[model samples]
Target: QSEDDVKTHKGEDQSEDHIGACRGENNFERIPVAVSCAEKPYKCSECSYSSKSSSYMKLHLLTHSDNRPYKCSECSYSCKSSGNLNKHMSTHSDEKPYKCSECNYTCKWPGVLKKHEVIHSFDKPYECYVCNYKCKTSSCLKTHIRIHTGERPFKCSECNFSCVTSGNLKIHLRSHTGEKPYKCSECNYSARTSGELTRHKVTHSLDRPYKCSECNYSCKLARDLNCHLRIHTGEKPYKCRECNYCCTQSGHLIRHMRMHTGEKPFKCVECNFSTSQSGDLKRHMKIHTGEKPYKCSECDYSCIKAGTLLRHMKTHWRKAKLI
Candidate 1:
């Protein structure tokens, strides 16, 4: 057949086999007539990748190999393809083409934009088996399940500390490293996590939205207000397994459990003095520094702790027959 006849066939059948036949007489002989006339004939054996173009198939094959020809100029990021390298370059820039219509959220990638869009939707497919808690993503549901299971998969190598999430574990590691990446804008206060910095920032603001009905107690967060309410109600929800001791806060329960387990996690760097509570360790350090922060108003006497100063004031009250 003439070249004009092949062009007519190309315009009629846009199949890969028809395109192969139009290439050369040898190409027409190589491709079998019985072969499937699929648009994406070039398939990768390594993965479920298939492409209509041979160049796209070759690029897909590079993903299966260790060869990274594309390198970023701004960073040490290297990718197997130019397309992926172009995506990596966005991290160096403030440009976000994909934006959410529902919110002020903007992302560099379309996949991330799609993920953010799910938050606007009322559909929460992922639900917890143990609780009524529901989330948009399966990963969120998996993290929420840890609360019921008491499973702490993320563990620290420096200490026996373990947390429900890897993000919490990462923040815990910063405590050992003394790395405070998040800083408060209002003060010189710094924290290991952004959440901690956010909470600290609230202290600078005079606006206390959460208030107690029982008393004049007020806080920045609803969780803090809930905790403060326990003081008026005398609700000790957190209980000890070994003893009848209970506390209103989970941290208090954790410290109380240490007494039964004989676990003194907080230790002094200057000496061999150790304690279960961090406040106890701080008070113990004062013995080394000879720092008496608590002072008596009635006398020239000063003490390391406020409790000691209070006891000392009681002696003057007894002298005046005030008791």
Candidate 2:
């Protein structure tokens, strides 16, 4: 009787082990085949779409919806991912953690710093298939592609100005708004843009980097040299559509156009007197304010305009008071 009881317990243990092994095999077969096959290519668990590269999957996730989970504390900036938001925060802090391996150029963002390093290394992996043009950045190559297509995606809302990039359109909008955000720390003068402010600062430094090929005349600003070159070339780029009046400078052309249109934008702030030109209005305002900006180099004589001072200097050249 004891031997029969021991034999029955052993038989039950063997049956349990066989059932457990079968259950394990069934679970292994029930596992999703797509998940196992997707091990080679990354698949977004949230969406079933699989991508060959992980970076493409990340970029594709942004297109699903307006999922801007990352927020910036310094400004009203947001991004779809935490990594992008972290990169943007560096701009506000002015912290450049990324340094170029080849040069002294540093950038707040790693992507920009990598692009700068390519310049020193002269590594242009991105190339145009249509042309001989090549660029270190894929973004730059995409922009160059627009040159072949003649695509001007950015357009000014205020005017007919159009550009290939949104950045150029932003600069063009300053002309309409006259918004000068760039100011000189040394002086009270400001400019519409940083580039203009930089050029204005060069005047204070008296750094005449641009020189004329024809004469010894030099100017700190490139625009001044371009205008000076016009003198040698006699190239009149500005022309009056109303009349045959032509001028080298756009301001002079604008003033000439006023003669035909009888349009005077400048008016005296004190009196109701107005003039067609700003210089005329400035001279007229001196009558009310009694401000003389021009001084005679010869004598203590002062005048409102340089032309008036020049006329006053003529008296010194002539004999004493006329009989």
Candidate 3:
């Protein structure tokens, strides 16, 4: 065989003696000829992954299969690879050895720290085709693409709840399991997600780090500060599709949309009462409990709603004006 017809295991040109030895009739050490110099011959049918190594291609194929041999002892978490199972096991503990240099961020995995470090840098290579959104990693760009495409791949078995990312689906599953993995160090308070725990931790501290430049208003969370700034800026970003109604918050827009759809999502467990808003459902619950929180100072009139108490006070005002 010609020198060009055979190559070493490392994709390198070998000596004539080494090539002759590999060319033996019963030689099992004969390395396969590479298809291209720079191209990866092994390609995945499921995804865009490609590898030059045959063993790596075999390992990558496992990602497409439902055969997960490795399982977690603490949870229902399972994976195809042992390395991934080892990484997931660290999440059950509070041990975070990897720390970010730019911030107080710490994670159990080195790859997570590497991803977190990108936030400190101004470089964002991945850009969205539909929007002006840019992110540091390709994984983040993939998640952002789902926003424009409206593709929710991760689904919940318990409900119709579906999300774009697996991380979001994992958090949503916690609602059914009643699992609060993130806990507050100062208090006994716990939260389903790290962001919720972070917001809760601010309540323990007296200092309000997020302050509004337009006003003297300050808040523990940056989210609240942004919402407060919308009041001064008149930036009603959340708009109703059915009507010309616009709102400062997404929750307000969701509630407004329910009015258009006539969706009574908040239903009373005790009675047949149902409402579009959660607060309305809460007030309905008070009726079943016989809890008249709103009382009139003029008389023994009491009600479940504040609006009823305000109307009762008007009766006193009318009597005083007549006197």
Candidate 4:
């Protein structure tokens, strides 16, 4: 047919094809034909449903009723289509549905699998108009926009603790309830978050997968690699507001601030002694318990503090020096 004739037919059938059809966004193809001839090239025998592709009609047939032909022998799970049955089988087989080509990472859900695949690709499709902040996915760019706008939609009902990401909010909620859902199977040790549990599991293994580019330094966790990178970059992002002091770690800056404020949060209940640090409080508690944890291998000498044991060992070093 001519190009003009095709356009005329398409315009005439556009309204007819959309009468009982899925919206333009939902459907992949919009085959617009003349109204009288728009009964679809392919029609379903069971229903008024019609599609240009038989595959689309086949999908619709599955939703007609709960008549699942494909069944899983391991479980009560069944599906109308073989494709869905294959996806369901992955659950019982202990296999990930989608795996990344670049890494050993795998995920059960397709949406999560797609997100994982983006990390391997160099494409950054989404970008912020305000700051030119680029992200691999649109969802990530949307979250990044919140940082510039200061739009914290996710808020905790317990307090004024607000965050940009939903994952951060989820991890924050565990703090209030003291919930440790991720547990180590090798030991009784559990963690508040999966990332913490993953780090704990690395202690059991000697393997350090993440390595630094600038130095020979390697670490078990990606976060440790990031922290090591900062040492080479000399990027002390964490700074004490009270003083000119800056640190690679936020924890170090927090402790430095405490020295200035004299805010000793950790207090010894038995005595008037208080400390700005948890480690100092722990050592103080050992005084009440008479716990001599540190010991010298060369002598039978033991001490409450590790520093005290090290000082005691210096006497033996001096004796060797005299000889």
Candidate 5:
């Protein structure tokens, strides 16, 4: 055979060897012949992809089949390769074998550790096609794409609740489960959501971090500060659909909607008396409990409502005017 006809196992040129003689006095070892491209030794019945090696064809066949021979003994998790099954087995144990060299990051799976390494690089390969938005991970890019596509793929199986991202859907699922993962140590107040817990914890703190530049008003939440800033700006984003009424916040718009709908959610325990607002229901409770919280500063006059106290103060003012 010609030198060009035969090649090494590493696909190196056999140009150094002669046709039928050795380079020196010692006989040359016969290198493995190059596999013929015309006749592919291995062919996958599942797909059109054919290869010279039987191992490559077998691996390709696994992609088509749902048959996961390699499975975890602890769990129902099944994978095509033994490597994936070994990775899945780590979930059953507290073994985080793979560790990141750059940081203190460690994970059970190598793939997870690889993803963590991307954070240290500070290179965001994924970019949104719709805008100039870029993020570190592909998952973040997928979530950002929903902004343009309006695709809320993740949905709650329990209810009609759906969100643009999986994280939002996970938070929404807590409402159905009644799961309050976050708890306040200061007060025994448990909240279903993290934001609720965060806001609740702020009541314990003396300092109000979110301060309004326009006025002396301060709050715990940035969202509340944003809403407060609208008071100075007079920027009412929410408007009543039924009427010409407008509001700065969405909560006000929701309450205004109840006015048009005639849907009274808050009800008195003593009577069938119901009101759209919770504050109105609390005021209605004073009628049953006879709780006169509002008091006049001038006289021993007290009333259930603040409006009644203002009217009672006028009587003291009228006497002073006559004097």
Candidate 6:
């Protein structure tokens, strides 16, 4: 063959090799191949694909399968391929492999680090085709689109509740079951949701992470902080239709409605007695069970009812001369 023809044949072979590599063949060793920046690329063997570097070829392969062969030596972390492993190593090295052109914040992974820098740059690259809402990531934009479409794919088998995402559905399930798997070791408090448990745990740690933007009142959770902010703003959005009673929380409004409707949802199996609230039913149950769950922290005084315990605490205060 002619020399030029031979070179053309070699280029074709390289193109085929790249395509095979992209299709998930571990053909190339870690050896680097140098090519001129201006040279036209060749197509892949298995598909119509071309890449400037062999590393790009390997990354493209990971998209086809769920294989994570590369692992982190420092931790039990693994990735679908070697390129991801290289990215994961940067985290342990404290290396900012990815940088934002607009901001100074650096990240270990190029994708995540790129996202962080977008906040400082105010760059909304991913725009929702349905709405004007813009997001930094395509995934966020896709999720937002569901709101417009009213597409709730995630559904709770136990209830009629449906959510746009699986994560939201999982959170909704806690409300029905009242299954609080997470508990605080320091306190008797527990919560059905992890977010609530996390907030409860913060109370033990004395970590008021949520600070009011308007005032000095801080709370362990963002919801508590929001409610506290309403106190400063004098915002009572929840109003009772039956009475002139106004509340800051929707839950308070719901309980107030029960008083007007004479609706006792909580009932005792042992007796025909019913109460408007679950807490009231629980306190009443103590009359039958003779369980004194509430006790005075100061003295040996204890009572089945929390109100009685409060009155008992006052007696202790009176004895201590504090009140």
Best by TM-score: 3
| Clashes by residue pair, model 2 | none
> Tens digit of lDDT per residue, candidate 6, span 129-174?
6434567877777766665454667876674445567767756766
Over the stretch 1-323, how does candidate 4's per-residue lDDT look in tens digits?
98867965666434554543642333333443433554565555566778766568658867767687898776565668898787656644435657877899987778778887887889888877754346798888887666445466677656555667777876776666676656687999977765787789999999999998888999898878978898888887555545567677645755676677666756676888888888999999998999898999998888898889989999999999999
Model 4 residue runs over 4 Å out of place are 1-179, 269-272
Tens digit of per-residue lDDT, candidate 1, span 75-119: 455668777788767755657899899989887899879887987
TM-score of 1: 0.54
Looking at model 2, residue 298 earns an lDDT score of 76
Sorted by lDDT (best first), the order is: 3, 1, 4, 5, 2, 6
* Candidate 2 structure quality by residue, lDDT tens digits, 110-182: 7666766666657889887755556788888887666445466787766444556776676676666665555
Error of 1 at 121 (Å): 10
Kindly report which residue pairs in candidate 5 clash with one another.
none
Quote model 4's TM-score.
Answer: 0.48
TM-scores, all candidates, are: 0.54, 0.43, 0.61, 0.48, 0.44, 0.40
Tell me how candidate 3 scores on lDDT: 0.75
Top candidate by lDDT: 3
Ordering by TM-score = 3, 1, 4, 5, 2, 6
After superposition of all CA atoms, the RMSD between model 5 and the true structure is 15.7
Per-residue lDDT of 50 in model 1: 71
- How many clashing pairs per prediction, in order? 0, 0, 0, 0, 0, 2
- What candidate 6 gets wrong by more than 4 Å, as runs, is 1-191, 201-204, 213-215, 293-301, 310-323
Evaluate model 2: give its TM-score. 0.43
Write one digit per residue (lDDT tens) for candidate 5, span 1-323. 65655544345564544422321212222323455667664555555676665556556667777687996676455669887677556645556789999988677777778877887877888886645556798887876665445456777777544557776876776666665555677877877555687788888888888998888999888898988898898877555545677777646766777766676756666888988887998899988989999988887888998899998899889999999
